[model samples]
Target chain A: QQQVKQSPQSLIVQKGGISIINCAYENTAFDYFPWYQQFPGKGPALLITIRPDVSEKKEGRFTISFNKSAKQFSLHIMDSQPGDSATYFCAASMRNDYKLSFGAGTTVTVRA
Target chain B: DTAVSQTPKYLVTQMGNDKSIKCEQNLGHDTMYWYKQDSKKFLKIMFSYNNKELIINETVPNRFSPKSPDKAHLNLHINSLELGDSAVYFCASSSAGGAETQYFGPGTRLLVL
Candidate 1:
């Protein structure tokens, strides 16, 4: 069973457009939610993360909207650029737990 | 400097052969983990070690063994490799403990022929 589920297995967005990816989790014990971005031939890097205590968190052009009640979260990239094209993965884990359950990854392509 | 690094970026070996992948981290993190990514891009956790102590071991087969000689290094050894063992393995490290941000290595692509 997949603990985390992400939508839009693949997405295409125009330059300067907004790119959004959504994810949901079934485990209520998961308190930490993180998003990762991966480029071709490279490992994934942490993008942004949020906890259930807050409804949203923004860093630069990236924003994470979280809904604890619904067990859902979404990542929005404002003014998406061509360089932002890559794969994104959403993961959830509980505090003090070493295991992280990752979502099936979404490949994003930005058209110039 | 690379925070996490894995050796043998690509490996192709025959079935039943024994192979080992080595990983090292320079971040001085107290926790390290091993993850496997399948062709469908599904990433799954295999094992986790903290301060050279085994902490997490998933439902992986007994043929797979993880060794940590010290706090800075973790290695995976597989005996009698099977075709299904083909996948990309990644090593990650985090400061403090679990539920923290993790730094990942580039990855090691293994192909069991």
Candidate 2:
């Protein structure tokens, strides 16, 4: 079982509010978790990532909460801005593995 | 400079036609991969190449083939294109080896009519 499932196919939040997206994986071998942000007509870019060793990782306004035992993770954007509106995808992979299992994806719209 | 780049951002072709999409990476990554995103927004891996060697080949149709002339380049060639082949194809690359951050190309939107 190498699937990563994400919830809330789409989300809408008011500007300056908080946007949260959740993801879960069935593969226990996954050690690295990454989130990606994609804009219309553009490639998906790495937003933030966390490892099993860390419970949480924050970079500026983006934060990732990871639970190793539960095999779940989530992405939180504080003070969400309209510019942050895009599709977010969560993926999991193991060390020395080239294949990355990805979730369905979540489209977050921070309206102004 | 663009870390990853793909040619023919949009392509429209008839079924059964053969077409090729080219990809290049300037990020000096040793590994590269190809992913297909369907109309339903599901992204799936098709093939992966590391240092010009075939590494991962998913359960994709035989009509789809991947070629890597160099470590920084990977191309996808589709023979006998079908209507189901219409989708966005993305090319991504990573540095060092596995479990590394990947850089993606803008993507190529293919429409098989």
Candidate 3:
């Protein structure tokens, strides 16, 4: 069974527009939430992460909004660019656990 | 330098054959993991090693075996390959402890005919 659920299997956005991806989980033990970006023929790379303690975290144009009570989190790409087009994945894991449960990836296409 | 690396970026073999994928990390991390990404882009963890010790083993088939000769290397060997075994295999590593970042390799694409 998939512990994490992601929406919008794929999305397209105009340049300079905003692209948002959402993910939800049911495991209360999950305390670490991370977003990953993957390009064609490349492995997924860590984009941004947020803990349940904080409601949001921003790094450059990428932001992660987390809601502990709702057991949900989202990734927002501000000023989406063509270079940002790739597959995005949301993952959850316990703080001390070595396993990371990943969601079905979302493909984002940014058109210039 | 590459933080995490895998050998044989692409592999193509016939059914009933045996193959192995090798992974190495130079990030001085104590934990390493193997994940499989299916054609539908669903990623799942298969195994994890901490300090060359098996820490996490998901419900994977016995035909798949993961070996860690040291802290920096983890190799996966599969026997009696089948068509359903085709997928992209990724290797990742991280520091031991709580909520550390994981660095992933370029991935090995395996195709079993």
RMSD of each: 1.0, 1.0, 1.0
Give per-residue lDDT, candidate 2, residue B18.
100
Question: For candidate 2, what is the lDDT?
Answer: 0.92
For model 2 the interface RMSD, in Å, equals: 1.2
Global lDDT scores for all candidate models: 0.94, 0.92, 0.94
- Candidate 2 lDDT over residue span A1-112, tens digit each: 4399998899999999999999998878889899999998888899988999999999999999998889899999999999999999999999979988889999999999
Model 2 is docked with a DockQ of 0.78
The alpha-carbon lDDT assigned to residue B4 of candidate 2 equals 96
Write the residue-wise lDDT of candidate 3 on B17-51 in tens digits.
99999999999999999999999888889999999
lDDT of 1 at A95: 92
Label model 3 with its docking quality class: medium
Q: lDDT at A12 for candidate 2?
A: 100
Q: Which structure is stronger by DockQ: 1 or 2? A: 1
B1: Cα error in model 2, Å? 1.7
Candidate 2 lDDT over residue span B24-46, tens digit each: 99988899999999876778989
Worst 10 residues of 2 chain A by lDDT: A1-10
TM-score of chain A of 2: 0.97
| Worst 10-residue lDDT window, candidate 1 chain A | A92-101
Native contacts recovered, each model: 0.79, 0.75, 0.66
Cα misplacement distance, residue A5 of candidate 3 (Å) = 0.8
